[model samples]
Target: MNNPEVYDIKAKLEAIHQDIKRLMEKSNQEYLDIMLANLKNDLINSLTSYVSDDIEHGLHRGMVDPCQMRETCKSRFTEFLENNTSLIGQENVSKNIIDEKRAELDEIRETAPFDKCDICFSEVNSLFEKQLNLISSRQIYSNTEKKQTEISSIPEELMVKSVLEPLSNKQRLQILKSMASETMTFTALSELTGLRGGNLLFHIQKLLESDLILQRHERGDYMITKKGYNLLLMLSNFLKFLEK
Candidate 1:
C-alpha cells in the first residue's frame, strides 16, 4: 500500500535480472575461450622446449599435434591437481565430487546446449560447490554495510509478508511449477495443474498480489516474474546444498 508503483518495481527487477543473465552468459563463453587458449599456448611452449631422443621434433610439419598435446595437457593437469590438493585443505580431490558436478553441469548444458559453453558451466558449478563446502566448514563474515545505510521507502515487513504469502500453499506452488518453463493461459494452466477455473483464479490472484506472476493485459496469459524464477532457483539450490 505504501508504494503505488509496485508493478513498476517488478518491471525494473525483471529487466535488470535479464540484463545480468545475458552478461553472465556472455562472460562465461569469453572466459572459457581465453582459459583454453592460454592452456593450449602453455602446452605448446612446454612440448617445444623439451625434445626427447626418440621424438626429435615437438611439432609435426610445423604445427603442434592437437590430439597428442591434448593428452599431454590432461596428464599435466591431473598432476597439478594432485600436487595442489593440500592447498585446498584436502588430501585429494574426490572423483565422486567431480562426477557429481559434471552431472549437474550436463543438465544445464542439455537445457540450452547450443547456448552455453560446457567448460565454463562446469567450472562455475565446481567453484560454487567448493565455496559452499568451505562456508559450511568455517564461519565467514557477513556483509552488512549496505543494510546499515539503506532506508526502505515501503514497509519492509509488509513487503516480506506479501512475497511469502502466495508461496505458502501447495496448489500455488504447483501452479508456479507449471508456469516455470513457459507462459500459460488460464485454461492451459488449469488443465496442467488440474485445478478448476474458480480455484485457479483464486491462487493466481494471490500470486499477482505477491508480484510473483504477471498477467498480460491483451490476452490474459500469465507468466512467472523474475522474482518468482529467482525464488524457485534459490530454493532448489538451497535445498540441495543444505541436504548435503
Candidate 2:
C-alpha cells in the first residue's frame, strides 16, 4: 500500500481496537462488580454465622434463654443465606451474559484489518534500543554522581534487553498505548486490549518483569514506569521522524 493508504489503514485499525477495548472494559467491570458483591455477601454471612455461634454458646452456658436466641439466630441466618444464594445466582447469570459479549468483542478485534508494517516495526524497535542504551548510561552516571551505594546496581545490558523484549510484541505495544494516559486495572486492560484475562496477565507479567511497567497500589491497576515513558517518548520522536 501507498503511504497515505497505509496510514489510513493504521488509523482505522487503531480506532476499531479502541472500540473493542471500551466494550471489553464495560463487560469486565460489570463482571467484577458482581463478583465483588458476591464475595462481600459471603463475608457478611460468615460473620453472622460466627456471631450466631457465639450466641448459641452463651445460651448453652445458661447466660441467656435458649429458645428465644435460637429462634432469632436461626431466622436471621436463614434469611442471610437466602439473600446471598439469590445474589450469587444472579451474579452467575450475569457472568455468563458478559462472557458472551466479550466473545463477540474479541471476534470483532480479531477480524479487524491490520496491515503488518514490518518497516514500522523495525524502525520502532531500533529507536527503542537506542533509547534503552541512553537510559542505562544515564542511570550509571546518576549513581556515580550521587555516590550513594545501593545493594545492587542495575546492569546496562539487562536494561536494554528488558525494553527490547516487550517492544518486540505488538500486543504489548497496544497495552502500553492503552496505559499511556492513566493506570488501568487488569480487567480494564484485558477488555480494552481485546485480550483474554489470562493472556493479558501473561503479557503484563512480562512487562512488569522487564521493568517496562509497574503495578500501581490500586489493587489491580498498572501504569507505565519511568523507563516505559522514556521509551514511549522515543517512539513518538521516531514516528515524527518517519513522518518527515
Candidate 3:
C-alpha cells in the first residue's frame, strides 16, 4: 500500500493531465470551426458576386436580351456549383469523421471501468453537435437572379441581425478581432483573449452557428474564412457610421 499523501498527489497529477488534454482538444476544435466559417463565407461571396457580375454585364450588353441574361446566369451558376461541390464534399467528410469520433468516445466512456463524469460527456456531446450543425448550415450563395430574389425577399435587417447576434458578446468580439489579423489555433486564441478553452469553445460555436466564422483545414491547424473578413468590414463600417 502507498502512503495517503502519495496517492493524493498522484490523483492530483492525473486530474491535471486530464484537464490539459481537454483544453488541447477544445483548442483544436476552435481552430477548425474558425477555418470552416471562413471557407463557407468565401465560397458564398465568390459565387454570389460571380453570378451577379455576369447578370449585370449581360444586361448592360443587351438590355432587351432575355436570352443573353439567361445564358449568362446559367453559365455562372454551373461554374459556381462545380467549384463548390468539392468544398461541400469536404464538409460532409469532416462532419462524418467528427460524428464517428464522438460515437467512439461515447462508447469508450460507457465501457470504461473508470467512473465517467456526466458533465465531461455532456460537454463533448455539445461540441460535436455544434460542429455538425455548423457543417450542415454552411452554404454558398449564388448571384443568379433567382437566388438573389430569395435573398432579397428576406429582410436586410434580419440578415444583419442573424450575423450580429453571435458577435454581440465582448469576448466573442475580441476573438474575432484576433482572427481578423491572422489564423490562430484555438489554444492561441484562448491565450490571446485570456479565456479558458471550454468557455472559448462555447463562444466560437455560437459564431460558427451564426455563419460569422468558419472552420478550415481540420487536421492540426485551422484557417479563417473570407466571410469573416467581410464581417469585420461590416462591423467596422457599422461602428464608423455610428460615430459619424
Best by TM-score: 1
Q: Lowest-lDDT window of 10 residues in candidate 3? A: 134-143
lDDT of 3 by residue, 46-116 (tens): 64465445444433453223443444433433443233333433523443444555566667457433233
lDDT of each: 0.60, 0.60, 0.60
User: Each candidate's TM vs. the true structure?
Assistant: 0.36, 0.35, 0.34
Weakest ten-residue segment in model 2 by summed lDDT = 84-93
lDDT per residue, candidate 1, 27-116, as tens digits? 999999999889856643443232221022221222223443434433433333333222233323444554564575456446542332
What TM-score, to 2 decimals, does candidate 2 have? Answer: 0.35
Candidates, ranked, TM-score:
1, 2, 3
Question: Where in model 1 is the C-alpha error above 4 Å?
Answer: 1-156
Candidate 2 lDDT score at position 111: 43
Report how far off residue 155 is in candidate 2 (Å): 9.4
Which residue ranges in model 2 land beyond 4 Å of their true spot? 1-160
